[model samples]
Every structure is written in structure tokens, then in C-alpha cells.
Target: MDRYGDSTQKPRVHKAEVMDEISSWDYVIVGTGPAAAEAAVAIRELDNRGKLLMLGAERQLPYQRPPLSKGLWTGKDTVEELPLRSAAEWDGLSVQIHLGDAVIELDAGARTLTSASGRIYRYERLLLATGGRARQPELAIATLRDRVFTLRNFQDYERLQAAARPGLTVLVVGGGFLGAELAAALSRQEGLKVHHAFAGNAPLAHVLPPTLQKVVLARYGKAGVQLHPQHRLEGLDWEDGSVRAHFTTQAPIACDLLVYALGMESNLELAQQAGLTLDKGGVLVNTELRSSDSRIWAAGDLATYPDPVWQEPCRLEHWDNAEATGRAAGRAMAGRSEPFRHQSLFFSDLFELGFEAVGRCDSQRVLRVAAPPGGGKAVVYYGDGDWVEGVLLWNVWGKADAAREGIAAHRPLMDLHWVETLET
Candidate 1:
């Protein structure tokens, strides 16, 4: 048995894979998300004939979600274009693909899993890559009609793409990455009412500092996005194919569509139901990505592995982090005893302002900024006393390598040079 702990929870078995006699599979991954797919691929790369199987609840092939909020709103892309890999590729790799069937229960003691379709799968090693789910308010907007949408998967985006039209009012809730990206996508459409609401002071205040937050908010404000900060939606009025939303401290606002960008909830029901341990925030895994049970292993959004660099349990929601973590977990499961180590990194583009951040943002530290007057781009470094901990940049592309290197090297501010790289 193995165990790991996070935030405020006792170490529970994150994974425990006992040998199964019914059938033998070297590795059986339980998700088709980035983590699952990457793990499967890595397993194949490690052992040519390892006998692997991948299970996905969604019928669609593994696809990227980042573009759904961007291209779907713009009508420039479709679900068919977002698949992570083609069926031919999966076939080529001889990966057993089970779509639309969700694993409902795990028998860690017996090293088996039961699917919703009543199929029992036996495995020597198990990987739980079940990613997180986009959260929503307790109740639907009173003003919400069938047209209101939230893009959680390809199908959700398909409905949202069909609903976004000219003269439509798009009310975006939350100001984080999803909300901002969805709002930005709507800004490109003409004659659209794009109103953004947030409970915080500015957009992405959790991940960015006040100065950078202001820049993002200002950019959105200029895009004709009505800002309503410190506001909470009380209810929505739906009538005659339109919706009117009631606010806490303001008059009711009417809109044609509402998109909620609230955070995400890690999918841990299967594990929790099986008596696996869970941290307050997510599944807890140690350096080996092994749960207390030792029979199961978890990675990606579902698994909160320890970060060797930060010396804490950190979960990243970025594409690269997910891929790297998945690969590491897969390698570790395939008999590699290397420790899992990955630094968090994320970036986004909004018209004129490009935002990027490395490591976790520490609000307690001082932020040193490097930007000229009236320059649209800047890099903010987060330092804990004398050592640089993280770096964030705006209008700074191709410089992420330098920023990452600087942070990793613990370069002092005195030794760093900031040269203007913006094209004049």
C-alpha cells in the first residue's frame, strides 16, 4: 500500500494496482484526456508490446479543449478539427480504444475496474487520468434559454458555436482564463453584446498581480466588453427567447446568452467511492505518483502530485504541464523509478496584450516590472527575498525561454537586462 497527502487531508491511497489473474494488461489507463493519451503513448514508447488499453467516457477521440473556447465562438473551427489523434493513429499504435464507457468502480484489492456498461477490466498497472470538470452555478440563469451555453466538451462547444450570432447578447460570468478567452472570442463578433462579470477586483487576480490585472481589464474594456466587477448574479429571467439577469447590487440586466467560466472540479467520484484517499482539493500522490493503495496511480488534473521545485503539492491546468505530467506518470508506471518533477507554465493571447506566467503567483512577494512608458508589453518577476521565484510577461513572446531560465537559475534582478524586443 502507498499514500500521499495534500492541503488538509490525510494520506489516502491515490492508486493501488494489485496483480490480476482473470486477464493481464501491463497498463490500463482510465481517461482519454491529455493525461491518459500521453500516458498511453509513453507506455508504448517504453515497452513495445506492453499490452495497453485506454478508456474514455466521451465518444469523441481525444481532442484539445483550448481551441473550443476560442475557435468555436468564432465559427472558425469544428469538433472534427480538435481531435488529439486520429483513429488511424490509434489503430496504428494498436491501442484498444473504449469510447463512451465510463469506469464506475475500482477494485483496487483485485486490480480491476467495472465500467458503466458492466464490463470488467483487469490490469497489472492502472492510470487514473480523469481530468477535472468545469463548474457551474447551483441553478441555471432564470433568463437562460436553451441558447445559453457553457463549453465543457466538444458537444457543449458545438451548441455554443451555433448560438453565437450577430445581435446576440453574450453575458460571460467569471474573469479567469476560460471567461476571458470566451469573452475575447465574442469580442471579434460585430453587433454582439459582450458583458463580463467577476467577483474579484479584476480579471485573473488569482494568477496575476494588480498591475497586470488592470492591463487585461483595460484591454477587455476597450473591446466593448461591459465590466461588472464585484457583482454576483442573483437570478436570470427567461422569457420569449431572451434572458434577464438580476444582480446583487444593481438593476437587472438582459441578455440573449450566458456563459459561465467558473473554475473546475476534479473528477474523483470513482476513486472516492472505492475508499481511495482524497485531498481537500484533489487526489493526493507522492513523488512516485502512487496512491496509498500502491495498486493505482494517478496523473494530470485528477492527481495532485508534489512539485520538487516548489516543495509543495501543486496542480497545473495548463496543456504543457498536463502533457509532461502524464508522460512522467506513464514512465513511472512502466517500471521507471524516476521522481515526477514539472514546473507550471501558462500563456494566453488577447488581441493587443499577450499574457504569460511561470510558477505559481505569490501575492505576498514584491513584483518587479520591466516595461517602458506607454509600451504595451511587460515582464513581472516574483521574488521571495533574494531569489526569483516566478516570472509573468505581457506582449513578450519568444522570451519565455529566457524568463524560465532566469527563474530556474535564480538570477538576481541586478544581473538581469530588459531589452525592448517589440517591433517598432
Candidate 2:
């Protein structure tokens, strides 16, 4: 039995039938990530009798992705416990799941989808929750594919885990959320050396302020992880079962395994083929999470919906956004129309430091740090002039709701009295 459950014990998954025998469904969902899974559950809550079908490219079921980088290494979570819902629960919901069968074509006019296996599925309403893929750097070391890996899905995690050994030196490329968390996690493993290299001066430089970036760098350094900041990866050279990474400004570092956490690229090929309106590399959707076509809806990382707080079209790749948007889109598809007004928050756990932040936490915005007089934990607000556009609680807990309220209020930073009341 694998982590996903017994391979011999199959659940209520639908196998590919004949192409001529068109299967009709009331709601057809593409992609089987958290977004698609939550959408199915939400739809069942409203209309239980509606025929729902979920198609996924991956072989495994929907599972929590954050644990792949955070909890898996800390011994806090196991791979068997990562699933969003069990097979029995999915069977009870009557949500027909079809794994390892990707939808290659979408006919919006005909309201049908063509799977890779050439089976046509007709639907009254469609939800595209096709999430993003890990962005890989264009390197000349394409021939050394086995030496490189990206942590996106469970399969990737399994491959990386199998390759990792006690004496192996692993080089983690990219300093975004994924890279930072992965470097921190891998460093905790005994007898393994971790090296983190990124283009920015510090980890999460694009999101965290300069002060916080320094703090994170210090934390990673304290954890015995080698840091290569402001280094642009130019090429790679394979040498006797090991790979040497060449950077523009730094010396080459040799490692047995390399993992790229460069971030994600939204999967937009299906939406583009369907002629959907796209913005900022994602499918454009309204406040109700509906696409240009009323019968089609988009959610999760691929859906660029109008953000009420940011007052602009934005797409989030966080787990919370996936669940919230998916639930809202499902309700709308089930004939319960309501605007997706829920404010989403994204949290990260990195080597004893954790934070839950709402709204835009961009580093470019004017930042105001409100800490105690002694300076332990703090609340950082980001905006221009008087309006509060984003908030970050550094090592602070139980203040995500207050942060959301402050951003939604769009008032001056001084008027947010709750910021001062936040304790360490």
C-alpha cells in the first residue's frame, strides 16, 4: 500500500469508456486539486442529486500541498494523512473522480470537454480549477534531467525523497516561499547539507520588507543552510554522478541533487484554447467567479478575479484562496449566486517563524511596522498614503481577522487601533 492508499483497492473512479458513448453530467470540474475537490463538496451540499464529474491529470487524489514542504520534514504530518478527502468520502458524495485522464480540449459553445483518451464529456456547467505548475528555469542541463527535480505534487515529493541520501549535498534554487521553506526543511535532516541560492538578496525579498528579509536570512544561516544571495544561475555541468551549478557572480557549487522552487506558472492552455478572457497570465473572472461565458466558471490559481480589497484583478495561488474561490464558484454553479467577498489569507511556517497575512504584502508598497516598545513580534502594514492595502503579522497569531478588517476598511494606518493592540 502506497501513501495514497492501496493500489489494488480501487474506489468509485470512472474508467474511460467509448468515444461514441458521450457521458453527460450536470457539473464537470477540470483538475483535482484542492479547488476542484472543494468545489465538488460545495456543489453536493447545495444539490446532492446533480451529476458531478472531476477530471485530473495526476494519478493521486486531491491532497494538501503545503505539507509537502513544511510538515513532511518536521515529522508533524505523514504522506498518508495528506489527502483532502478519503476515497469513501468521495464515494459518499457521488463525485465521480477520473484520475490520470487530462482534459485536452474544451468546447465552450457545445459545453463539452474532450479528454486525452478521446472521450467526450458533456456538461451543463463547467469549472476549470486547473492549477499552476512549477516554473522550471531554462538551463542547458536538460540532458541531466534525472539530477533535477521540482516539488509540486506528491509524485515529485516521492522522487526527491528517494534520491535524497544521508551524505548528499542538495542545492535548492529559488528563494520564494517554496524555496525558503524547502531549504529550512531539508536543513533539519541529519547528515544532509543544504544550499539555497536565489536572485534576490534574501529569501522572500519580493514579499517581505528588507528588515524581515534579513531576519529570514539570519534564521536560515542559523539553521546551517548555505545561502547564495544575488546569484543568477547561468549553467550546469555534470561531473561523475554529481552536478556543478555555475552562477554569474558566485563560485560553482557541486551537489548530488538539485530542486527548483522558482514558483509556479498558471496552467492556461485549456482556458486559452477555449477562448476565455485572460489577464495577468490567468483566466479573467468576475466577482461571482464566472468567466466571460455564463456557463463556465474559473477558480483557484488560474482564475484572475476582481479583488475587492486590492480594487484590481488579481490571482492568488495560496491554499486558502483555492478553497474559498472553489466553494464560491460551486455555489454559483449550483444556482446560488453570490459575490466572492471572502478575504483570503496565506500563512507560511519557516524555522520557528510563522505568519498569517491578508491582502497585498508586496515589498514595493510603503510599509509601517508597529511593534512593542521592546520589539519582539510585530504587525507590518503596507499601503500608499493613508489607505491600508496589506498587513503582515510577524510571528503574531490570532489576528488574521483583524488584519482583513483593516485592509477592507481602507482607512489610514493610524485609524486602525487594532494594530497597536496586537501583542507579541
Candidate 3:
């Protein structure tokens, strides 16, 4: 046996011996959400020689969550229509897909990961786009069968769609974006009674100021959406599978279904176990989206990184932020130095009205805004008496372009005469 090889003489090795080992990709993305999918493609495009593997928890191909709130629920788009890429497309790109199994643990020191199915993957660099999960409130009726539902994924959306039919009484628990959209969707269905409960005076009250909140509430009211402001849900009493929702404020309201849209918590268990630092609930990443563990990077809702445009720490759960952050994280993983700073672009539709915004809404600012000509308008929100903190619009498409550009350039909205001209 040749236990010892010559120090000076080179040892001959068969080509088969070197080629027998499977080559792990340079990058291993822990999720297949909007950010993960985008990151994978960007990585491939940036360096063609580098291998790419996208790990997803869901069985289905990567898809967008926005459509779950709008198109899918409304029956305007099918599940297939919202996928990140079709089977053929992913196959053509040579990007490996691992669906239906989540990464159970992360070993940063060893640069390896263990999946739920017991598969092990080693990577030179890892990206966490794990996203977040919906937070469900503790309500008694929520335990009952067919009485409560939380719209988080495709399965949840399908259940919600089936439950949101005519003559159904739905009590939406939260006045935030998801709650507002759900209420609007349920109200549009014939004979469906939708009552939305908010802990504040108006919908998104805490996030938006009194004036904008009032307008949002008013719009919801006009759309046959019942608003219960300043009230909290006590519990629910079930009778014959029906629910009587008890509130802290006035009276008990009988409803068939309850939906909670309070907020979301990032899936950072893997990051935490791997000794990665986190900000709030997400993995804390640097300007280049690198985590405390230099071998790892994070993006999407699971990442709490610095926002260059906002000039502060900001975490965005919007679709645009997901896409941008994913691209930035991918590039960063590839050793690029570009900053991952982003504009907080957001959009939503409640029945006939469409709303979009860029930057954080300056709830306290009073910017003179013009009415949308002949029907639609985009309202720019200001903060610090100068900066354009946010923009909100109704029935306005492409208006986000200006707000996005202005925020990216760090320009103050006050300099624009359009704002002063509308004041008088």
C-alpha cells in the first residue's frame, strides 16, 4: 500500500477520481420566495461558471405573494400565472431546485446546511431569503373547524377563497394592508357581509396620520366595508360551527369567519441557531447584505438591513423591496460591493381603488397635494419638513416612478413647486 507519497515526485491520479465528487454550488439560497428566485437568476447571470441551487419549503415552484392578496383571491389570475418561472424555464437555466423541504439547521462554521429531508449541502456562500410567517392572534373560535383562517400561502388562499362566498359573515381582525384588502375582497362578493375591526381610530391608523387614515377608512366605508375602530377582539363563541365574535368595546358581533392580518415574524430560527446576529425579528445584514457571519447574506422580509434612501434602518415586506434586495444580496454573495439600499415601493388595491407609495409615509407631514385630474392622484408625503418620506396614490399608475426617483436621489419634495402651488 502506498500510504506515503513522494514529497518531490507528483502522484498520478485518475480523472475519474476527481470527477466522482459532486460539485456543490458556489451559492445556496435558503428560500424560493420573490427574493430567493431573483437572487438565484442574478447570481447565474453574474457568473455563468458558478453553480446555483434554490431551496424552497413549498412544493410548488417559486411564486409571488402579491397575487395571493389580489389576483388569485379575486380569480383574476391562476396559481400558474404567478410563478417566478415555469418548469421549462428553470430547466433551461441549469439552476437546481429543491422544493418541499426547508432547511432545518445552518452550520456556518462548516459552511453546510441540513434540510428537513436529511439532505446536506455545502456552499462557499449562503443567502437567506427565508421570508416570514403570518402572526395569528389567539382567538377561541379560530380553533374551530371552518370558522377561522389566516391567509399566508397558496393553501391558505384557496381555503379563504372557498370561505369568501356570498352570504358569509367575515370579521377581519386588523386594519393593516392585508386586513383592508381582505375586507374589500369579501365585500365585493354578493351577499357577503364584511366587518373590519381595527385597534386604532382608522385603518393603518398608526402607520398613517389621522388625515390619510381617515381617507382610507372613508374609502373602505364607501365600499360597504364595516369598520370597528378602537376596539379589540376579546374572543369568539362558537355555536353550531358559527362564531359570535366578542369585542372589547361595544358588543358581540356574530360572524361566520375571522381573519387576522396583524403582522409577520421572520423565519430566522436557522440564522439564530447558526449564531447570526439579528435586528428586530430579521437577520441583521450590512449595507452589502452580509450578516454577522461573513459566509452568509440575507434579504427579503427575513433581512433587516440599512436603507440608504430612507437614511435609517428600514425593513420592507413589499414586492419591489424583495426583488431589489434579492438582486443586491446575490451580487454581494458574488463578491460585488454594490450597496443594497432600496426605495420602499408599495402598491395595493381595495375594490375599485388602487393605491401605491414610495418611501415611508410621513404621517405627521402636511404637504399640499393636488386632486388627481379627472379622478386619480398620487400624494407625496414629506418628513423633516423637506424630504419626501412617502407617496400614496389612488387610481394612479406609473406615478410611483417620480416618487421612486426623487427618493433615490435624496431630493426633498418641498423643493417642487407643485406642492406649494396646490397649497393655495
Best by lDDT: 2
lDDT of 1 by residue, 78-134 (tens): 645777888778877868777767889888878888877666788888888898888
RMSD of each: 7.7, 2.4, 9.6
lDDT of 2 by residue, 1-424 (tens): 1346333433324543444778999999999998898899999999999999999888788899999998998888998889888877888898888876789999888888998767789999999999999987665666568888899988888788878789989999988899988999999888899999999989888788877887888899899999999977887778777888889988888898888887899998889888999998899999999998889999999999989776589998899999999999999999998988888999898988888889888888946876676555777788888677888888899888877876787757777466664533
TM-score of 3: 0.87
* Cα lDDT for residue 140, candidate 3: 47
Which pairs of residues have clashing backbones in candidate 3?
none
Off by over 4 Å in 3: 1-23, 139-145, 207-215, 239-241, 372-375, 408-410, 417-424
lDDT of 1 at 423: 17
Q: How many clashes (backbone N, Cα, C below 3 Å) per candidate?
A: 17, 0, 0
> Which is the winner by lDDT between candidate 2 and candidate 3?
2
